[model samples]
Target: MTYDTFQPHPDLASLVKCYWTLEVPPAADSQRQRIVPDGCIEMIFTLGDDIKRYTSADEFIIQPRAMILGQTIEPFFIEPTGYVNAFAVRFYPYGFTSFVTASLHSLANKETPLELLFGDTPAAELEQKIIPATDAKERIQIVEEFLFTKLKSEITIDNIVKSTVGALLETNGVAPIKSILKDDPSKRRQLERKFLNQVGISPKQMGRVIRLQTALKMLLNRQSDSLTSIAYESEYYDQAHFNKDFREFTGINPKEFLGHENMELSSIFYAD
Candidate 1:
């Protein structure tokens, strides 16, 4: 498997972390990989075979070749056919909704087809452009040009969305909804409505996921010896608090997570 990440255009830097492409050789098998939430939305265009998102061993759905995977509240499993070729845009929490006209809440925990948001023709055209690129370098260039030409034209970020993302990043995903809106609890309700429409997960849930991401990286790096230390450093109430949150996000305790083969693949994205 080959994975590469690229810098986005200057104007979109804050909203988009980078464009990325992944390739796996024919007959190679991709283990079930788990991606923890990172307070962002992603737009993926498959250059080859479709990928399946599994809820468990038997339940799953094939994600559209071109789709937006909104802020996930829970971890899911992905199985991609070898020879996987795809490009994706990783958006900051506040960056993606700028392009959406519909309520974001409706997209939460959902793999929304790009056609649903951008119209079928446009979505189809975009996928065709990415999948056939000669190589990874070309794939990145194509996606960057496509996003720059299209999304830059439609980019829009409301004030509420900005502040909500600020609160989440500021507190590292541990901020409470009420605390986030101490200035106006009414804003809290409004944010929740907007989050559901634009973010797919409640603000509170995004915060916790963000916080867990911080701790996850530390564990991967062997930065701490005990769960208690990691918990305190991550701002959880205690070790138990850390364990509960860890299990919630990865479906396993920290000790088990570090040694599991599947966790090895997941650690790449989860790293701080």
Candidate 2:
């Protein structure tokens, strides 16, 4: 398996987290990989064999060749049919809304084909250019151009939403929404409405996901000697609180996460 991430263009740096690519050889004993939410949206392009996203214990569906994976509230499983090669753009929590008119809440927890968001002709053209790109740099260039064309001229992110997201990220998702808006607690309802339309989840949900991401990296990197210490560092109430949240997002306890076969792909993502 090979995974790498590249910096986004300066003009798009604030919105796009990074452009990433993954290539893996077909394995004889591959197991279904678990994918957990990470508080970000992704635009993905599959360049190799099709992959299957399990809808249930046995049912599954082929992921779109070019699609937008919205904010997922729960964990899901995916398995490669054969070789795996993919290029994707990881966007900030509020970034994608700047380029599309659809309410993000409608896209939560599922994959929507690019055509549905960008329309058939534009989406197809972009996919064609991306499919034949010679390298990650070329693909990045292609996607950036497409995004630039779609970017709104005026600021699309509402001030309250951007600042709240900023506060959540700056504190590694542990900051309380009320503290962020101590000056105006009445705005809580307003923020929730905006979050659903722009971020696909409530502010609290995004915060929890972000907090879990911090703890996940700590586990993946072996930064701490124990889960209790990690919980303290991550601002969870206690080891029990940490374990419950971890299980909720990852569908497994932290101890079982490391060295777990199904976590190979997820580990690569968070470890980086």
Best candidate per lDDT, number?
2
lDDT of 2 by residue, 156-187 (tens): 88898999999998998988888888868799
Candidate 1 displacement at residue 35 in angstroms: 2.8
Q: Could you tell me which 10 consecutive residues in candidate 1 have the lowest summed lDDT?
A: 149-158
Residue-wise lDDT of candidate 1 within 1-272, one digit each (tens)? 67778887787797788777777666555677776667678888777777878877888888888888887777778877655777788888767766667766677677899989888887788778776677767876776666665664655665676787787778777767676677786687778777776666777787888888888888889998888898998899988888998888888888888878667557766563
Model 1: residues with Cα > 4 Å off, grouped in runs: 26-30, 149-155
Q: Which lDDT value does model 1 have at 110?
A: 75
CA lDDT for candidate 1? 0.77
lDDT of each: 0.77, 0.94
Angstrom error of the Cα, residue 59, model 1: value is 3.1
| Model 2 misplaced stretches (Cα beyond 4 Å) | none
Report per-prediction Cα RMSD to one decimal. 2.3, 0.9
Q: The CA-based lDDT of model 2 is what?
A: 0.94
